[model samples]
Target chain A: MKPENQTISPNQLFYLVSVFLLGSSVIFLPGAQAGSSAWLAVGLGALEGLIFLAIYNALVRQHPGKNLIEMNELVFGSFLGKVVSWLYLLFFLFVSAMLLRTFASFFAIIMTSTPLMVFLITPLVVSSFAVRSGLEVLARYSQIVLMTLVLLFCLESILLAQDMDPSNLLPFMDIPISEMLLAIQNVAAIPFGEAIVFLIFINLVSAPLEAGRFMRRSFLFSGILLVLYAVRTIAVLGTHSTISTYPAFAAVRIINIGEVFTRLEILLAVVFLSLGFVKGSVFYYGAVLGFSQLLKMRSHTPLILPIGALLLNISTLLFDEYIYDIIDANMLFPLYSMVFAFFLPLLTLIVAKIQKRRIQKGE
Target chain B: MLNVFLVIIAYILVGLFEAPGLIRNKYWRELSIVAVLLSSSLTLSLLLAMGVRLPMIIPVIYRAFVPLLTWLGIM
Candidate 1:
C-alpha cells in the first residue's frame, strides 16, 4: 500500500468522523424511540457506539496505515481475503446509497418542492467534486461544515429554550424495558454502528496515537448533543414528537419567540444539509477508496462520477411511492446495518487477533 | 409513475456524463456503475408498486409551521 502524502490533524479527523456520524438521523431519533424514555435509549445507544469504537480501534492498532481491505489480506489468506474485501466494498456502496436517499427524502419533505432528483443530484455532484480534489480537501471541508453545524445547533437551542417545557420529560422510564431496548437497538444500528466507515480513514490521521482518544471524545460530544436535542424536541412537542414524522422539523417550526423570531426551520435545514453533505462525502470517499484498492487503480478520482451516477439512481428508487411503509414498518435497514457495521467488523477483528496470536507463537 | 421515470432518466444522464472519466482504467468503476443502476431500478420499481402516500401529519405540521415562519419574517 502506498503511503498517503496528505495528512489531516487529529482535530480535523475528529470533526469529520463526528459530523458524519451525527447527521439528520439524530432528528428522527426521538420520534423513533418515542416515549419519555427516549433519552435512555440514546444513552444505551452511546454505550453500543463505544463498543464499536473499541472494535475499530483494535483493528487499526493491529495494522497501522492499512484499511480493512489490506488488513483482510493480511489476516486471511489471499483467496478468502479478496472475497471478504469485496463484501466490505459492497457494504460501503449500499450505505452511501442509503445515506443519499435519506438526505433527498428529508430535503423533499422540508427544504424544497423541487423534484427529489434535483435534491439528490446536487449533493452527488458536490461530493464527486470533493472526491476529485482528494481526501485532504474533504477533511478541510468537514472542519468548516462541522463548525457551522455546531454553531447553528447552539443558536437554535438557545432560541428555542423558552418553548421547552420540563414537564414533558416527566414519568421517565415509564416504558417497559423491552421496548426501551428495541429503541436503543434502532439508534445504535442507524447512527452509531454505521460509523464503521471510519475504519477506511483511520490511517489518515496525523496522530495515530490520538485516534482512540479523538474518537471517544467526538462520539461522547455528538451523543450528548443528540440527547439534548432529543430532550428539547420532547419538551417542546410532548407526545407530538412521535406523531410528527420529522420531530426536529416540527420542533423548529414551533419556535416562535415573541412571534418575531420564528420560521428558523430553514436554518435547521441548512444545518441538516451541511451534515448530509459531510456524511455523503465520507461514504462516497470510502466507497471510491474501496473500489480503487480492489481494482488496484492508480487513483480513485476517475471512478467518482460513475459511482455518483449509480448512487443517484439508487437513492431515487430506494423508497418508491410506498416510502411511508418502508419507514413505518420495515426493519430491514436496522437489521442489515447491524450485520455489516457491527457483526462483520467484530468478526474480522477476532479473526485478525487469532491469526496474530498464531504468528507470534510461531515466531 | 411518470415522475419516477423522469427521475430515472435524469440519473442516467448524470451517469453518462460520469462514464468517460470512470472508464479510463478500472474494471471496478464499470462494475459499480452496473450494480448501482440495476439495484436502484429494482428498488424504485418496488417502491412505485407499493405506492405509499405521504402521511397527512407532514402537511399539517407544515401548515402549523407557516405562521411560525411569518412571525420569524422568513416568509
Candidate 2:
C-alpha cells in the first residue's frame, strides 16, 4: 500500500518503531519522576503504551489501507476530517520542534564553546536529507542506526555495571501514587503518544494488518530496553538519579573501567544524538507528507526545507532555555498530547463505530 | 553583529540551494511556501541576533490549558 516503489517490509517496520520509540525518552526518562520507583513507572508506562497503541491499532485496522488523514475523512465528513487531519499535522510539527529543541540544548550545554545554532541546524539538515530521500531509504537508514544503538546501549550498561550498588534500588515504591501515575503518564505521552504520528505512515507499509503484529513486538522490545536502562540509572546513581538533570549521562560519566574506559560518556552522547535524529526525521516526514496530501500536491519534496526552517525557528522559541524545556516536556506535554493521542482518536473511533452500526442495520 | 551576518548569509545560501530546483520544476506553490517560511525564520533569527529576547509559547499554552488540567486533576 506504500506509494509506488515505497513499500516497507514488516521487519523494517519493526525496527523503525523500535528506534522511534527509543528516541529521546530513553535518555531523559530515568530522571523524570517517581524517585527510586522510576523503573517501576517505566514498566507501568510500557503497559500504558500498549493500551494507547491498541487504540491506534484499532483505528488503523478499521480501514485497511487508508492512513489517519484518510480515515478521518472516511469517519467524519470531508470538512471535519480535514480539520482533524490538520490538527494532527500541527501536532507533528510541534513535536518535531520540541525534540529538536531538546537535542540542540543538550549540545549547547555539553559543548559550550560552540554556538547553539550549529547544534540546532546540523541535525535538522541531516534529517532533511533523510526525509527528502523518501520513506524506503529512511527505513533502511533507521535499521542501521537502531543496530548501532542496541550495541552501544548494551556496552554502556556493561561498562557502568561496577559502579552500580544494588542498595540504590532499595527503599523503592516510596513515592506517592499520584507521582507514580504522573511518571507513567509522562512516559506514555512522551514516547508512546508520539507513536500517534505513525498513523500517518499507515499506507506506507506493504501490509497494514501486519503492522499490528510488528508494532506490538516493537513496543515490547522498546519497553524492555527502557525499563532496563531506567533500572541501570537507579542502580548506578541511586536516589541521586531523582535529583540530577541527566542521571543516565552522569552515571555514564563515572564509568571508570580500570582507569581505561573513563571517556565512554561520549558514546552515550552519540546514542542520544543519533536516536534524536531518527525521531526528528519521522516527525518531519509525517508533517511534510500530511501537508502535501492536504494541499492536493503531487509531491512533498518542496516542503522538506521550508518546514524544516520553520521548525528550527520554532525550536529556538519553544522555551527560554533547556531546563524550562525539560520541565514543560515532562509536566505539560502529556495533557497536551492526550487530545491527539487519546481523546480525538477515540472520538473518531466511536463516531465511526456508530455510523457502521447504522449502515449494518440499514442492510 | 557576526550573528546577524551569519544568519543573513544562511538565508541567502538556502535560497541559492533550494530555489533553482523549485524554479526548474515551476513549483509555484512550493516556491511561495519556501519564500514565506524562510522569510519568517530569517526575520525571527535576525531579531534574536540583535539581542532581542523572544517570548516563548509554552507559558501561554500552559496558562490556557491549566483549567482543563485542573478539571482532570492532573495539575
Q: Going through the candidates in order, state the TM-score of chain A alone for each one.
A: 0.93, 0.97
Identify the leading candidate in terms of lDDT: 2
**Candidate 2, A106: how far from true, in Å?**
0.8
Model 2 superposed RMSD (Cα): 2.3
Can you write out model 1's per-residue Cα lDDT over A165-283, one digit (the tens) per residue? Answer: 88988778887665676678777776788788877777778887678788888889888888877888888888778677778888988878877988998887777777877788878
Q: Please give the CA lDDT of all the candidate structures.
A: 0.72, 0.84
Model 1 spans with C-alpha error above 4 angstroms? A1-5, A111-113, A322-330, B1-75
Fnat for every candidate: 0.07, 0.64
What is the C-alpha lDDT profile of model 2 across A284-361, one tens digit per residue? 999989987888765677777878878988888888756667568767887789999889988988998899899999
C-alpha positional error of residue A330 in candidate 2 after TM-score superposition, expressed in Å: 2.1
